[model samples]
Target: MYRAGIDLGGTNIKAGIVDEQQHIIAEASVPTNVERPYQDIIRDMAELVKTLLKQKGIGETQLKSIGIGSPGTIDAVHGVVLYSNNFGWENVPLTEQLRQYFSCPIAVSNDANCAALGEVKAGAARHAKNAILLTLGTGVGGGIILDGKVFEGAHAGGAELGHTSLICGGEPCTCGRKGCVEAYVSATALIRDAKRAAQQYPESSLNAMCEGDLSHMNGKIPFDAAQDGDTAAEKVVNDYICYLGETITNFVNIFRPDIVLLSGGICNQGKKLTEPLETYIQDKCFGGSKAFIPKVACAVLGNKAGIIGAANLISGKER
Candidate 1:
C-alpha cells in the first residue's frame, strides 16, 4: 500500500507518496495562495494531490491513509486546526474537508510534531525510541516523540518546547508570553538582539554587512559574522546558544530522551552552533548521571522528515 504525507506551509504546500520502506515514490508541491483565502489554498492542495495521482498511476483505493503536517495549533485527533496565525485559519476542519476527496483515514499534526515523528522514524533520531526535533526558523518549533510515537498530550497542544518559558518578563514573544525559548533563540530574536548590539558596536562586520539595517538580517548575518570571528555576532550567537542550551538541558533532565535532533537553517552552521550548546548542556544539565547524556545531533532529513514521517504512519497494511 502507498501512503501520502502533506506539509502545508504559508509559502508552499508540499506532499509526497511513500511506499512501505518510506521512500518517496512520487511527490508534488505548489506555491500556496495565501492571499487567495483559505478555501482556495485547500483546493490548491487537493489539486496537487490529484495531480500526483495522475502522474503516479495510483487511485485513492491504493492508499491506506493521509497525514497533514500543519503549521499551527491543530486538533490532530479531530483533524481541526484550532487556530493558525500562519494560514489565517480558526477552528477549520482541514482533515474533514480533505476526507471528502479521499475516503481513507486522514491525520494532522503540527509541523514540528510531524518533524519529531519523522526524525524518530527515519532521520537523525532513527535509533532513538524517545527523542525531540527542534526546528529553528523565523520562529522556533519543536516536537517530542516518545516510545516511537508522538505523545500529543491531553490537549494535543503540548510539546511547544520552543515556547516553553526560559526568561521571565524579558523579551516579548509572539505568543504574548515573555521570554519564551522562541523569543530568545529564534531567527527573529537573534536578529533583533544582534541589531540592538550592532547599534552599540557599530563597527562590527555584522553592522557593516547589513549596512546598519540590522532589522533586515537573516540567519547568514550571525553565521557569516561568526565564521569571520566578528565579536558582536559571535556574542549574539553565543548568547542565543546559551539560552537554547539551558532550555534543552531542562528537557534532558525531565525526559532523558535518547536523542535531540536540531533541525533548522541555523543548525546548518553545524558545529559552530552545536559545540557551544553541547558544552553548556554538559555543564548545566540537572543530573550528575554521566549515563543520561542524550546524543545531540543535527537533523538528517532536512525538509523531508515530516513528509516521510507522515507517510510512515500510513505505510503498513491497509485497514
Candidate 2:
C-alpha cells in the first residue's frame, strides 16, 4: 500500500504519494498563504493529496495512511498543532479536519522529527537504529530517533534540541532565550557573525562578496572569504564551527546515537564543516575510546526528507 505525506510549511503545502520503498511516485505543492483561515489551508492540503492520488491512478483502498509534518508544538496523539509562530496557529485539529475529506489513519508530527525519520528510513543513517538530525536553517531544528522510532517524549513536545542552552547571557534568540544552540548554530547565527566580522574588518573579501551591503551577507559569504585566505572570514567560520561542535558534543555525550547528521545549507560546506565537527565531537564525547562513538555526516535527503518520512509514518501498518 502507499501513503500520503504532507509537508505543511508557512510558505507551501507539499504532498506526495510515497510507496513502501520510500520513493515519491506522485507529488504536488500549493501555496500555503497562511494568512487565510486554518480551514482553508487544511482544505488545500486534502485537495493536494487527492490530486496526487488521481495522478497515480490510485484510490482510497490503495492508500494505507496519511501523515503530516507540521511546524510548532504538535500534540500528535490528537493530530493538533498546538502552536506555530510561523503560521500564528493555535490549537488547530489538523487530523480531524483532514479526515473530513480523506478516510485514512492520520498522524501528525513535528516537521524536524519527520525529517529525522526520513533520514533513518531512506537517507543518511539508514542502517542505524538510533540517530539524530540537526537542520541548520533560519534556526537550528533537531529530531531524535531511538530504536527506529521517533521519540516525541511525554507531551509530544520534546526533542526540541535547538532550544537547549549553549551560552549564558550570550546572543539573544528569537525564542526570547539567551545563548540557545539555535542562536549560535543556525544559518541565521552564521550570517549574523559573518556580517559583524565584515563590518569590523573592512578589508575582508566578505565585504566585497556581499557588495558592501551588510544586509546582503549570507551563510556562504564567510566560507567563501575564508577559502580566499581572509583572516577575518576564517575567524567567523571557525567560531561558527566551534559553537556547532560544542552543541554536537553535548548531544553526543547525552544520547550516544549511532550517527549525528547535519542538514540544511551548512551541509553544503561538505568536508569543510563535517571534518572539524567530527573531530570536536570525538575529542569531547565522554569515554570516546571505550564506548561506541557516533559518526558525523551530512544528511543526504534534503527537502524531500520530511515528505517521505511523513508518508512512512504508519510503517506498513494498516488502519
Candidate 3:
C-alpha cells in the first residue's frame, strides 16, 4: 500500500512515503553532508527512512519497496554507486548498505532517470508512451521514457541528452565535453551571460541585484529583467532560448517524442522561456510538418516528482 522514496541530492537527502496512487503521504529530510565521512551520509539516509516510517505509522511489512534517485553513475541491478561527483562515492553498494537497516527491497537509478520515470508515472508525461523529461537546474539532466518504460542503454546510462553536442567545440563543460547544451543553456550559462550583459550595459539593474556576486546570479536574472522589457536582459534570455530551442529540436528530429516536459527552477520563468523555445523548436526540427511540433510543457510535480518517481521504479517488481 505504500513505498519509500529517497532523492539523494547534493545538498539534501529527501525521503518520502508515497501511496500506491503516487501521492506523498509523509516526508522527512536530512542533509547529504558530502563533507562528512561516507558512513555518516549513509547513516543519514538510513535514519531518515526509519524516522518517516515510524512517525507515519507504517511498518516495514506495509512498504512495497524503496527507491533511491542518486547522483552520478550507478549499477542499479547490483545497487552500486559506481562513481559520483557529489558525494565522492565509488563502487559503494548503497542499497545493500541501507537494506542492512531497513530489510526491504530497494531500487536505485541515476537522479535524472528517476526524474524522468517520475514524470512518466505521475507527472507531465503520464499520458504519453514516449517522452523526454529535461530539468534545467545548475546543469542539465535528462530522462527518456519509451513505450511506458525508462529506456536504459546497454550500460544503464542512456539519454545523456544534456551532453549531446549542440555546437562543436563551442564551450567546455564540466563533463569534459565541448558544446554540450548545459554549457550553453543551463543556470550556470545564464548567470555567465548575465554578467557579460551587465558589463556591456553598466546602467542595467542586474548589477545591483547580485551585487556582483557571480554565484548569486541565476537563470532568473535575465528572465526577471526580460519581464521589465530591458534590452540587455532580452539579449541574454533570447540567446538562451535560441540555444535551448536548438537542443530540444534535435530531440524532436531524432525521437519525435509525444511530449517533452520542462522542469527545474529556471523553467518557471514561464512563457518568457517556453514561447521562444517553442518558436525555435518549430523552425529547426526537420522531420515534422511546419504546422506541428512536439508538445512541450513544464513538469507537473515540481520537486516532489523525484520522490514520487523514485517510489514508482518497482512498478512491476515486488517487495
Candidate 4:
C-alpha cells in the first residue's frame, strides 16, 4: 500500500508518496502562503497530495494512509495542533479538516518528532532501537525514539527538549525562558556569540572574515576562523561545544539512548563537530567508567527527513 507524507511549514507545504520500503517515489511542493486563511492552506495541502497520486498514475483508493508533520505542540492521537507559535495557530482540528478530502487513515505529529522517526526508520539512526535527535538551526528542535517507536509522552506534548534548562538565569530564549538548551546550543546562539567575539576582538580572524560587519556573521564563521588558528574563534567554538556537550551529557545520563543524532546545517562541520561532542560526552556523562556512551552521528536525510518521518507516522504507535 502506498503512504503519503506532508511536511507543513510556514513557508512551504511539501508532500510525497512513499512505498513500503520507505522511499519517496513521487513528491511535490507549494508555497504555504501563511497570509491566507488556514483552510486555504489545507486546501493547497490536499491538492498537493492529489497531485502526487496523479503523478504516480494512482487513484485515491490506492493510497493507504497520510501523515502530516507540523511545527507546534501536536495532539497526535487526536490529530489536532494544540498550538503552533510558528503560524499563530491553536486547537486546529487538522485531521478532521484534511479528512474532508480523503477517507484514508491520517495522522498528525510535531515536525521534530517526525524527523526523529524518519532517522530511526531509514536514516542515520536506522541501526538504533532508541535514539535522540537535535536539529540546531534557528532554534533547537528535538525528537526521541525508544524501542524503534517515536516517544512523545502523555498528550503528545512531551519531549520539548529544546526548552529544557541548560543554565539558570542566563541568556534569554524565544520560549520566554532563561538559558534553555535552545538559547545556548542552537546555530542562532552560535552566531550571537560569534558576533560578540568579533566586536570584542577586532584584530581576530573572525572579525576580518566578516569584514567587521557583525550582521555578516553566521554560525560557520567561528568554525572557519578556528580552523585557520584564530584564538578568538577557537575559544568561541570550544565554548559552544562545551555547552552542547553538556546538554548531550544530560540526555545520556537521563535516557541512555543507543545514539544521539545531530541535524541542521551545523552538522556540515562533519568530524570537526561530532568529535568534540563525543569527547565531551565521554568525559562528562554520568558513570565515569561503565555507562553506555551513545554514538554521535549526523542525520542522513536532510530536509527529506520531515517528509519521510511524517509518512511513517501513519504506522507509528503514537499515531
Error of 2 at 127 (Å): 1.1
Ranking by lDDT: 4, 2, 3, 1
Q: Encode model 3's per-residue lDDT on 185-259: one tens digit a residue.
A: 777877888989988888777776678665677777777877788888888887888888888888888888888
TM-score of each: 0.93, 0.97, 0.92, 0.97
The alpha-carbon lDDT assigned to residue 180 of candidate 3 equals 91
Cand. 4 TM to true fold: 0.97
lDDT winner between 1 and 2, please give it: 2
Name the 10 consecutive residues with the lowest summed lDDT in model 1.
310-319
Candidate 1 per-residue lDDT, tens place, 1-319, comes to 7888888888899998877777778887899877777677777777877788778999889888888888888787688999889777889888888877888888888888888888777778888889977787888888877788776666857778888888978889899999888888887887788888788787888888887776677777877887798998888888888888987898888788998778877777788777878788888887555647787888988778888777655432122
Worst 10 residues of 2 by lDDT: 310-319
Cα RMSD of predicted structure 3: 2.4
**Candidate 4, 270-308: lDDT as tens digits:** 999999899889999899659799889999899788889
What would the C-alpha RMSD of candidate 1 be, to one decimal place?
Answer: 2.4
Please estimate how well model 3 matches the true structure, expressed as its whole-model Cα lDDT: 0.81
lDDT of 1: 0.80
Tell me the spans in candidate 3 whose CA falls farther than 4 Å from its real position: 208-216, 290-292, 316-319
- Per model, state how many residue pairs clash: 0, 0, 0, 0
